[model samples]
Target: MTHTTKNDPVRAGLDRRGFLRRAGLLAGAGTVLPLLGAAAGPTASAAGTADGDPDQLFQAGEFAAAGRIYARQLHRDPGNAHAAGQLGYIDLLSNRFTRAEHLLGRAQRLAPDDMTVRRRLADCFVRQDLLARAAPLLPAAQAEQLASVDGTPYAVDGPQATRVPFLDVDPLPQVRGAVNGGAPATFVLDTGAMGLTLTTDAAQEAGLAPVSSTAVTINGRTVTTYLGVVRTLRLGEFELHNVPVSWTDGSIMAFPDGTVTAGTLGTALFYHFLTTIDYRGRALVLRRKTPAQQRAFRAEAARTALRPQPLWLAGDHLPCTPGMLGGYGPRVAVIDSGTLDCGLNTSAANAERAGIPVDWDHPIPVNGGTATVYPATAARMSIGAAVAHDVPGTVGPTPWEGLTGFDLLGNFTHDFFKPFAVTFDYTAMHLFVG
Candidate 1:
């Protein structure tokens, strides 16, 4: 079955009081109640009366309904840390960072020894760009809790992990391509990026000439970007020529740990093939599916659109525009791959001048520190041939003009091609497949 959080569409308007009453009865039946008290957050009442329905709602991804139940519980007993922590989580998911921070902080105070609360609180700091605050708590947070099982800090083990099946070419081939005539080098498969971006140093060494240039904004600042062409590019058993490349100083961050992998295979390559990233097997499989497989994949892809996008290492993009969230007019947003929800800038108007509905009745925590998020239903978004309506997103204050991250990409997964065989033809406005 497809698992979802309490925010599932089907359970939107559930009753609050009845849920809590049922939860209390369920807790009474379970012997695990006593053990849970010392675990974290709120202390069970003498009868251990808890309306477990809210907890069930949370587990089911009905975040809004779960929040309502938590609110009622908190109203009855303000000292309930469990309710507070859950409330914070709901807020965090909704992009309500400030409120989340406050509630999470309270939960931590109520249950000082609870590692889960601490870790969640730390994550909030990371989302808010307060990395320094999060660094201290990283050691205590379990890696599994940080992100999904397929996420980082874990690598595939065993012999099967060593091979990747996608490359029709040889797996470990050498290349004679250079950025500015410096030295022959090899690159690695990187499905995370949207385009082929080379480091400034690599472009300078390969003797590639700049074909054109433009400026794009990053972290609220504009930076110049260079487009160039490579005479020859090579991968395991594949090679191509006259390929386009983008050069940027930002590419340096790709090698933060300094492992000697040259260039990266980006989304430009993956779009051409049916790609599978098997994290457990430690291999990326890419194969040209048969016509039937293609048809099936396209059908499946339509449903995948609503799922959260993976926050890969590649940077994110958001279109630049003046848009309203929470009834506010024109606040800059950052298209954040790392973020699971949409957020509004703090200056956005809370009054509903546009038809947008600002969710003040249900405030959610953004992370777990001081921020809270207001939910909003986006009326429409226009992109190329795609139009999204009634999309649920968040409103928050950010330092960027706007973000074009996964919310814009919808459910499109990228394919990274071996050099030369694939190209992103911006001028032609099409992904040219070999």
Candidate 2:
């Protein structure tokens, strides 16, 4: 099955809207990773276990911690140019261009040929849309990605259900469905998923003939992908039409850990109905939401024990909720069952404030590159009374200064999400972490 390229698959005469994501990086398979382009832009040499090691704090999204460590390093050794340069780097990520220029300039004078200082300052200038400023600082090849466009969005709709789609969670939480009205197929119920993704094998089995192809990068190689519609996708009593889909030769955002389903029923489809994931009872509920019912549901949602948090819509229009990091950040975190542990995808500054221990020896592997994320355990994470102790997690990067607090909300695969029922109402822009 070959998919020829369609000029622009997104805007090709379908109902479309933007689905926003708060974090800059795409999360890894059951792991959190920054939606960062490459590690070539800027970096610094590592110091001791508890200092402003860019790889450790910067990549772990612990900007707050990195800032503190750098400040301490500077206080001890006022003339440490390395500390000054790193501080300048923080300013750059935070969009404080003037200050970044000042600090990096001083550090540059101190160490005339520091590539790290040069590249960071360049990236900072690029963020401000000042090509001339960045031109002198950046290499020709590196500048292109600095100006890349945003990812594409999709439109998803289904027939009004005569009966609500409620079924047992089957321990693994997979429900039987069909692709293009073919034989029954398996799909994992995942709220953290960005969209309904299908593997090439599954797409072929379903006779998902590709109409157009889109080129994307993975593992540093450009791969051509097909985009088409799943004309008649069935899930229980519901029928979905013209659901935009992508095929994968490699693993994608993937279904849960153990089972290999045909595809995932992620947020794209979830937006159309009232959804509930009941972990204790092992049940999944889906019902159409009428205007009056939506209003009533939202009013009742306020009363649920599940702590209600503000879920922002990403460029993709997915829900992002506020969550605390080690009891410190009531900040942005995407609720991803796809990610492992409560991975910290924020900045070093926010991470240091959380007081979580940093694992300096290892770097977490992202899609094509790597991040300096330290493994950490927790005292307790406050997801509004639903807390998990000693949770397995990673601290990631805080590429921008302004993004210090936002990180991925703890992944739902953790035992904590197993007790109570959870609900995410896209219309209401609210998530119930009950």
Candidate 3:
């Protein structure tokens, strides 16, 4: 959430007393129950109702709005560790390392027992490529592993730019990839993932051994995964060395043509360059994030009439942008290229608030099971400078919000990006499409 925007009216419309009441900060009467811990103030709701309360908004995937409210609460109560920590988390999501350090440090000082805050602080350091700074806050085993790679983590050696031509483009973007000089296998370019992810079959085929193990949630199910490092990864014309990777027992996907997708190349790998998933061009472009390269890209964009839209690196790697649902005010939205079926996916409350009626009588099929998801047409929708009317989408629970710390109003899927040649400028935190 930003301090200023065209949607500032939504923030202005909320008076102090009403905001406090909705936030459950007022006296007993009309008090709403807190969603999580009592000390952290109010949080969320059940399935059907949509509350404008900050906590409810946070739980309902309206993170930008919730963040604005949290900022206000922090302004009023400087000692509120919960508020500070939440702001810090938002900063971490935005890739504002210094701001996250300050806020999380203050929150840690106020509530020393907050492990979540501490972990988030460590994550901030890790994202900045400072393993030494993050070591002390991590567990002994993880710290030791980080210390081992303190000298050179994710070392890269290649040209300034490389293009990985798509091998399969039906369900998602796939390319031929290899690990540690292993045989080439089909891999997905999934932006939803953090680092490199591999299936157990692929890991075995590539002869990788586990360095550590951790629990992760995939498709609403928790699964155990083994972490390892790739001595070298071959993707198109580039080579990345000393890269951390994780392997799980789960199968990502199998193409109808009987091609097995072995793994994924995620943000941790692409953040080193100005990456572009050119669906129209049928290739993944990786350009070095150098001053000359950025200047050349800007010049090309101007020549081609491509508009650059501001984006935030949220959570581990989600590219979030300000967007509107139907006619509702702008909120945080993630551009997730991984979602294949729908152009847009959102929460029921947000859909209802935006004047799109949810058809609870008819449910839709999802990956795990059937859900209260239905097809609907948004009268008006927008993300950054891109706008559309009568857009098709799906409205449901949106379980992925948990992965992103409930910091999104919806997800614009690969279908939404298929028409353009999209470029992600990580350095400037901007997205350009043509």
Top-scoring candidate (lDDT): 3
The lowest-lDDT stretch of 10 consecutive residues in candidate 2 is: 13-22
Show where candidate 2 strays beyond 4 Å: 1-173, 250-258, 295-307, 341-348, 398-416
RMSD of 3: 11.6
Over 1-434, each residue of candidate 2 has an lDDT whose tens digit, in order, gives 33222221111111101111111112221111111222333444647655436446744545557767877776787777787887776655444668878888877777767766765666455434454566455433223322221221112245443332324443335667787779987675655554455666788888876544434343334445554556666776676655555554444323233445566566556655666766666656665667766666667766664456554433222355556767676654555444433423444455578776767687664433423455666555656666666655665643222222223443324344666676766555566767
* Tens digits of lDDT, candidate 3, 1-434: 00110111111111111211122111110010101111212222213223346666665555577678777777877987877887787777667778889998998898887766767777688777787988787654355456556246667678888899998665778888888899898887766656576776877877887665544332344445555677888887888777777655443445444555777676767777889989888899988789988999999988977788767775445677767886686777877666544567787788878897656666665433424467776777776566666666788766444445654678776667676677888788788866
lDDT of each: 0.38, 0.51, 0.64
- In angstroms, the error of model 1 at 214 is 1.9
For model 3 the TM-score comes to 0.77
Q: Which number leads on TM-score?
A: 3
- TM-score of every candidate: 0.31, 0.57, 0.77
lDDT of 1: 0.38
